[model samples]
Target: MTDRSFLDWPFFEAKHRAWADEVEAWAAAHAARLTDEHDADGSTRALAAAMGEAGLLRAACPADGKLDVRMLCLARDILARHSGLADFAFAMQGLGTGAITLFGCEPARDFLADVRAGRALAAFALSEPEAGSDVAALATTATRDGADWVLNGEKTWISNGGIAGGYVVFARSGEAPGAKGLTAFWVPGGLVRVVERIEVSAPHPLARLAFDDVRIPDSHRIGAAGDGFKVAMATLDVFRATVGAAALGFARRGLDLTVERATSRKLFGAPLFDQQMTQGAIADSAVEVDASALLVYRAAWLKDQGTPRVSREASMAKLHATEAAFRIADRCAQLHGGLGVVRDAAPEVLTREVRALRVYEGASEIQRIVIARAETAR
Candidate 1:
């Protein structure tokens, strides 16, 4: 119901357009039952099951083990427009299982079938209390013990934390310092304990996990011991552009709400749309939305076209789209006046939900740094 005209852009193909329409239709049909507004964990579980049953999770795990970045972006964009929670549910499934799809051994690959089927939920455990954007600061350790690795440490801000069936956990395994010593492991969720459930301004199934002598076989290790950083970066590089696409969804929805309010509401003996200020806000939001779409699809397109890594492009897209979405949401809230401040009002809720997108999956500041580094190197 928002604007599908963006699909006509050259960045997408006929198949991408068809897939986008299908996802939008699916989201519309299922949005009402897909999320429980009051229960983050419950809603995530239910949404995952529903997405699995619909075979939508297949986009997250293609048969060839190579994810279609364009399809991923299109799906996230459409789903986020319908429901932020739905977008979160879908994004986490892809992100949580990404390392496995990209670098896992046979056992890790076997888990993908259950994950895609929604019988098993997946979690990506990368962030810790001290290590967030700074991956080199991670303190978690996985020590070798004969055929198994004993994992001991804590991971925080984990999506699908308490509810996930398995986790892709990164920890220090070698004597080398910094990211070079880190390794990625596939740990069964039952082996770890959730220390605390986190509640955000926008509800999500986030938690802190503790690993106390948890043992996973060497077969569960993803990539090489020193390649954890590469695996995590590669996984992130692929999905980061999709984050921008999700922000575009939120911005599109916010702009639609603002347009409705502007056209229907009256102020100073005239329709709100007649006011220059309202017109400027709408125009600015539209431009931002289009700009966001351009950057998001550009990154996705580049990756799909065989660019080994689109880190710089992905960072720029995420940085701009998330920041622009936040601004657009704020403007929409302002245009709504007192109605927007109502706790659960559409614009208010969107504003709150979009706020977190700026911080997660590499914060805006980190994105700036990445861009600067890339530009300077060029």
Candidate 2:
């Protein structure tokens, strides 16, 4: 069965355990959204609305602005185990408004409640065609015009791009050069147009967007002109571990589904579990699932404890969990034989979803560099 055993670990508080129970029930109740193949945009919007109605979106926008990293991790773990699309909806709500949650003034933070309530959607517009993981290479520019900022550039691979009511955009504001020259702003979607829609193996409203001299008052800026890098990195610090948690969920689900299949599927007048070869595969995946969980929760616990700048821990968690989860999905798919390759199969779906996780937020190579740099600096 689905493991609720992680909730008892010391990484969680009593209230967190109770909250996990709630999310588990909610996820089970909405099993229909487990697959995100058809009409991804509509599915994402519907999932967000459902999660908002259930009050789960509150985790994405805590009233205190001090997000409980443990809660965020647990919620993502549960929801991802049930439906990755649900996790996507919940995660984007937090990530899309993460700068505001971290640095926005009262005026900018005003619309967060609307996002949390599902009345509006938000997108994180940082990656550009030339700058997927290289944040400094982004060509988007926001020029100062009197008291206003005028944006002109393009952003690609943006989640919730077209449907979002607003976006958290990062662009070069020329404070210094390279990374330091960036700034964060809140741009309404009305000012930007979706130029193209990009589809992946697992779909989720992916798009490319363009801004042509879109003007906004200075109030929309998320932080000071020179602070965009800090704002983006800091926001990533809060959500990075949760990405690991999502990967962990996928790994655990992979393990469970494989086990269920192995125990029931017969080969040569015996269950697949009776084969030592099958047992070896399942055993290896089980160990990986636990290892992934430990790394994921440790990073989250550290964040919740206010150990600021968890770049090392978060990177390690995300790197290992995503890689291991994909491996586990691969193993499970192999064990499933021909069924795994069929459209919409559990292993097929997970392999696709986990593959994307390694590329987004930061690539696996980027995360490895982040972790190694942190370690060697000591």
lDDT tens readout by residue for model 2, 1-378:
777787789998899998888888888887454445677887788888888888888888877787888888888888778888888888999899888988965665657888888778889999998998888898999899999999999999999989998899999999899999999999887888889988888888889999999998998988888899999999999999999999988888899989998999999999999999999999999888888889989999998888978999999999999999899999889989998999898889888888888988998999999998998998
The TM-score values for the models, in the order shown, are 0.98, 0.98
- Error of model 1, residue 331, in angstroms: 0.5
Instruction: Please name the candidate that would achieve the greatest lDDT relative to the true structure.
Output: 1
Enumerate residue pairs that collide in model 2.
Answer: none
Cα RMSD of predicted structure 2: 1.2
Off by over 4 Å in 2: 31-36
Worst 10 residues of 2 by lDDT: 30-39
Please report how far candidate 1 places residue 201 from its true position, in Å: 0.6
Query: How many pairs of residues collide in each model?
Result: 0, 0
Predicted candidate 1 versus true structure: per-residue lDDT over 1-378, tens digit per residue: 488898898988999998987898889999657676798888888888888888888988765787999999999999888888899888988999899888866776667888887777889999999999999899999899999999999999999999998899999998588989999989988898999999889999899999999988999999998889999999999999999999999999999999999999999888999999999999999999999999999999999999998999999999999999999999999999998999999999999889999999999999999999999999
Clash list (residue pairs), candidate 1 = none
